[model samples]
Target: MTDMRAAFYDSYGDVDVLQVGELPDPRVGPGEALVEVRAAAVNPVDWKVMAGGLDPLMEVRFPAIPGWDVAGVVRAVGPDIPEVEVGDHVLAYGRKDWVQAGTFAELVSVPVRAIAHKPAELSWEEATALPLAGQTAARTLRDRLAVTDGDVVLVHNASGGVGRMGVQLARILGARTVIGTASERHHDRLRELGATPVVYGEGLADRVREIAPGGVDVVADFVGGVYDVSQAVLTEGGRYASIAEHDVPGIEDRIVWVRPDGAQLQWLADLVADDRLEVDVVRVFEELEDAGAALRANREGHGGKVVLRVSED
Candidate 1:
């Protein structure tokens, strides 16, 4: 067995715990494909998990790799797998039952159910940026909220990575009108993506009401702390889903947790390929040794996703 270079941590902590070094290549299971990682994206959950934020909810093993998004080439497939062949370009939200061998590595063995063909229209960085954010948006809007034709959708914190995807996907899901809440600085970008932008603040509900007098048909909250306003603007019987704000009263059933679904990922990839979706990648860290910095960059916040280039294209 050969050792592969990876970014991992021996114990839970902050970015300082991450180290770039050699680890044994992950074993390919019966339904998995060995991916030669080209790029990986850093999500908020990655660093949170590193700090043991999810310790109560999910089990973690030491020497854990912290990442969930990957875009790569299939180097080999495990036995009984026929869905993807070697040399196929793929992207996935490769979150497993437990966190150990993750996407922040030179190689990762991805379950076939979580792998989707990467669109040629998207670069490795862009492809890597899509999986988690895109899937989160889809899970909230398409799956949970059931966004449909003629629906007027409202996306909270619509300038962030997942919120941006939610805004565009709302329109793509046949929304007659899509209203996005963000700061004034991001309003123009929201408009370009087919959303009516409203500045989020004291009058957020009023601003959204001005756009959709009857109220929004669906509300997707990617950022927490707007539960009051979200409820105020949601029409009676309207669907509301949140990836954040799980602590709010009566929102237990409304909280959405994104899972790895290859079919859903492929739908998002095809949308990007057909020019119906856009992936915003704000920064790219070129070295695996820079993983700590990448995690910090994501935590500091940006308008788009931060990605790590694991291998040259």
Candidate 2:
């Protein structure tokens, strides 16, 4: 059996528990493709799951390799798979049915349903960063909220990885105005992305109201704990969706859990190819040994996507 170098942890803990070592090559199952990982994205959920934060919701096995977003070349294909071929550049939100083998490694087996062609315009780091955050924002604003022309959209935590993507996607979806809640340091960056940046905290609703006197037509809450403020500023019959909040009363599907959708990812990649979307990756940590630092960088709030480069493209 072949082996691959990867970052894995035997038990759930902090970043310190992660170890760079060798593991068996991932098996290519039917309808899947074997990717030689070039880069993998670092998200908050990687460390959160490492810390056992998802204990009740997801089944996590011991010696779990952490990372869900990947950009790489297809090395081989499983039986009956035709969506991708060997040597094809691809990216995927590679979350499987369970938590075990993952993308922070030399190779990962990804279901074709989660795989999309990586556009030449994107670097490995950019492609790696796009799948999860981009898909989350698209699912919330485009798919769920149905943001459209002349809509006034408000994005909470607009400076965050998902929030930044949300801001850009709202513009792509034809929103006339976007008000983003972010720290003062990220205000200018948010403005550059076509959002009116408002500092979060006290008077956040007032600031949003000042931007849109009538009310916001849609609210995308990337950061949790701002439901009251969102409710205060939303117009009557306005739509709302949250990735981090789930306690809203009377809303059955308000919380959006992003799924692996290749078609959705392909659309985002095409947008990147055409310069309609930006994959804002602020930092890239090279090699398997730097996985801990990569996770720490993501946890420290870098205001953009973080990537771990596993191999040269």
Candidate 3:
């Protein structure tokens, strides 16, 4: 009987519901790769799923292993899958339509579409941090809003994992200027990333207007509830997109759902190799059972990515 240690929750509740124990080894279905997880990042969605917030939206079977991001080595490939072979280093946004089990385990089986060669320049934790947040940022700016050169872009919560990625992607896309909203503490870091930093809160619209006096060309809202500021600051014919707000009251805005796309992950990895992008793995919990603590850190809004080092490798 093959078994591996994993963090799982049999019932929906708080972080207390999470438990670490042995589970039968997973099978790799055709077109799937069994990855030996080296590191996995804890995002807000992981705890939310464990707490049943997404129960009505996505199916969750009992004893669900909770996580969506992983950086690891391919241990085996199912028959007919030629995209990746054993021993390949890879990373994935391992999202499934339904939750059965996930990446918070030593070994996770993911479809080929979700697998990308790990960025040559990134460490395991950094690679794990890239998928979910990086994809959200890239998909919104490149596909939904289509930001281009000479365009002024405004990003809400620019210091966060997702917002910071948006700031860098905007620069890579040739935006004339990137304006970011953050607390006073993160303002300097935002400036270092080539963004004009504005303290987030009252007078946000006015502050953004002052930076891009002619009005901004695009607005990417990572923090929700910024509809008013988005409307007030966008130029006529400007585009608006949000990862947190699904529906806006007055305007047509796109709500981004980060999806798993190996090709898109490769694009992000390339940027990392070129040193044009960065993933800050701020905290790492070494034990698998410490996943609960990792979730708590995410809940507390710890700055940058929080990762679980699944193995020393």
Candidate 4:
């Protein structure tokens, strides 16, 4: 096995637990492809998993690598991996059932079912940014909320990565008018994305009601603490879903932990290739070693995705 540098955490804690050093290369399992990672996007789950916040829900092995979103070239294929060949550019929501090795590394072993061809029109960073957030957004809108044609959809926390895509995807999926919540600073940008922008916080429901009048037909909550707002503004029998796991009184909304699907990714990639979809890569860390910083930035909640460029050096 070759030696490769990776960002891993030996124990659960703060960013200080992260280590950037050499480790034995991962073994590609049957039905998997070994990818040479060019970029990996960091999500809130990376930091949460690293700090043991999800200990009750997941198993974490020591010296665990700390990312899941990867955009790379297939370096090799394990036995029985007929889906991808060496040298194919791909992206994956390379989440294993358990936490052990991950994508914040020079290479990753991705299941064939989790890999999709990267859209040629997108940069590596942009492609990396899409897997986790984009999938979550797409699934939340399509499956969980059951959004459909002419539905008045409201996207909460709509300035963040998933929320931004949720707004766009809702439109593409035939939402009549998309309402989104963000800070005053992001209102114009939301408007440009074809969403009716409203400031989040107090009286949010009122603002949404003014725009939709008859209440929203669907609510995609990327942020917690908005169940009350959604309830107030959603029409009777309206659907609701949240990417976050927050406790909200009286509303039984779907709490989505999105699963990896290469087919879904391929469809989304087609949209990106057609220029109807865009990924906002707000920040890119040039070194994989700074994965800790990237995780911290995810918690800070920027306008778009945070990514790490895995340096070949």
Q: Pick the candidate with the highest lDDT.
A: 2
Poorly placed runs, candidate 3 (over 4 Å): 247-253
Model 4 regions more than 4 Å off: 249-253
Candidate 4 local lDDT, residue 284: 90
Q: What lDDT score goes with residue 306 in model 4?
A: 92
Taking every candidate in turn, the Cα RMSD to the unseen true structure, in Å, is 1.0, 0.8, 1.3, 1.5
Candidate 2 residue-wise lDDT, 176-272, digit = tens: 9999999899999999999999999988988888889999999999999899999999999999999988677766579999999999999999999
Each model's lDDT comes to 0.93, 0.95, 0.90, 0.89
Clashing residue pairs found in predicted model 2: none
Per-residue lDDT for 1-313 in model 1, tens only?
Answer: 9999999999998789899999999999899999999999999999999999999999998899989999999998999998999999999999999999999999999999999998788899989999999999999999999999999999998999999999999988899999998888888888999999998888888888899999998999999998888889989999988888967787799999999999999999999999989998999999888899999999988688999999986
Best-to-worst order by lDDT is: 2, 1, 3, 4
For 2-96, candidate 4 gives per-residue lDDT tens digits of: 79999998899998888899989989888899999999998888988988998998988888998999999999999998889999999999998
Worst 10 residues of 4 by lDDT: 244-253
Clashing pairs in 4: none
What lDDT does model 4 reach? 0.89
Better of 3 and 4 by lDDT: 3
Considering TM-score, which of the candidate structures 1 and 3 is the better prediction for this target? 1
Which candidate, 1 or 2, would have the higher TM-score against the true structure?
Answer: 2
